[model samples]
Target: MNDGLNPAWLRAFVAVCDTGSFTRAAASLDLTQAAVSQQVQRLEAECGPLLIRRTRKASLTPAGVKVLAYARDMEEAHARLRLALADDDPHVGQISVASPGSIGLLLYPRLLALQAAHPGLSVSYRAAPTADIIAAVLASRAELGIVTHRPDDERLRTELFAHESLCLVVPAQMDDVSWPALVRLGYIDHPDGMDMGRRLLARVHPGQRIDQLPVRGFTNQIGAILDPVAHGIGFAVLPRFAVQAYPRRQAIRVVDTAPQVIDSLWLVTRAEWPLSASAAWALERLREHDWLAGADAPASWPAHDNG
Candidate 1:
């Protein structure tokens, strides 16, 4: 007699086991509850009773206990097989990446180039804040995330992607670098300004409080923060990536300070989920980018340690 084993039956069995609820398994697999039940019944017929019923739940029978191990192994093999097939045509898959608006601005050109190089590949990049990027990666909405800070979560695997130096930016015409001149210029505060603000305060006036510093302007948008500074309204401190690409870069320049401030960029992905072939390829490309080498920028930004 034929074993009559089927991948769908195995998938349904594993989904139910993983979810612990047939209803939840059905919803997760996008299959009808009746359909999932039928699939499980088919598997049970093939391998004897697989699940033992309990109040509000189910447990694996001895047979299911054995079958689950084999089912997972089979799923891994299937995933590898799909990956192998995808490798033959790396240009035919999709990968999603999430980054903050500043990083997105710096990465967009490279993303366009990636798509151009592989016409069949689809790339989706979302501009979100660090918190939102982490949430997107955890939710499986995004396969990769790049951000300035890493969270202390065991579920995330982080690597040092790059180091971006912070710079005090003033109107291009502002030539004075004295403390009095800076105090007169005041600070253009934004949502991301707090960290830079604190660092700037420590460097500008040691032992002085942040509230003691003059606040000239305020905004929530990163891109908008630079415009006022460029027009001689007030000065703001920002990451090199955010400032270097501004269309009006010629209008503002980095102010050399006694102690330099730097922000390290981290690449993060969920530790539990294996990357798909396309995502892995994209990640490799990103890893190979020249920025990771950190040669062009001045020595103000130090290399990151361990991740």
Candidate 2:
């Protein structure tokens, strides 16, 4: 309710509630006891109410409790901003990106190589599912998010990060021929990745019999899906990046198919903000790795996916 917001006073107020003593709160804030008391008084006067009960254990009044919650949220936001600021390097600014587990492991090492070149450039990483990564970018919680595939939201600025061949991996012991027969063998599918596989299925073998699809064996972990495939519980689908090595003594084999198809990886970000220097470096490093794999490099970032 105060027209002149006192962020410092809010800090002091929360400190008092946490430490349960004004003297301790003043020490924490490096302010004198009288100054802490004065700030509390001013905050209360502005809000037309008392915030804390002055007793052995400091506690919030009904009004103080409400303000305290808001203060905590504000403090958290400020803390994030401070971290971002601290990441600044003379050559590049700090960037925070959210990505999926598989791609992040495969991709972030590429950025680490760039650290030698762009000493000032730095990157922070967070892991989440595709939908969660999109949400993070939308809320401006991260500068960018590297998702396995493009998000459903049309507003996101997305660019093709990479496209590597993918295959339907099944226990080597279970051999099958053609697309029609593969589905009948029961697949341990990933629910989050079902959409991409849906596209593949639609193209390769439209309307194949899925009666044996094994919807019961579903998981979000790529490794779990692979486990079933390895032990021959059912076939699993995974990107080539997840495979690490071919065959690897696992009783798994790529389904017999021609003209292999691959899943697309996308780097998504807000359309409005200029790409931070650190993020731009990371994006370029990702592109460099893609090119290393004999794929075309991205012409530019901050691109949109019409699909």
Write model 1 residue lDDT over 1-307, tens digit each, in one string. 1464888999999999999989999999999999999999998888999999787888999999998998999988888678656665556667789987776776767776788998867888898888899999999888899977877889898887777766788899999966678778888988778777677657756776566558889987767889988888888888777776688888887777656556677889999967777778877776687754431335654543323
lDDT of 1 at 253: 77
| Cα lDDT of model 2 by residue, 105-208, tens digit | 56566656666677766667787878888888989878888777667676688887665555667777776645655656666778544654554455556676
TM of each candidate vs. truth:
0.65, 0.55
Model 2 global lDDT (CA atoms, 0 to 1) = 0.67
Which model scores highest in TM-score?
Answer: 1
Stretches > 4 Å off in candidate 2:
1-94, 108-123, 148-156, 178-185, 193-198, 201-207, 244-251, 259-262, 290-306
What lDDT does each candidate get?
0.79, 0.67
Count the clashes in each prediction: 0, 2
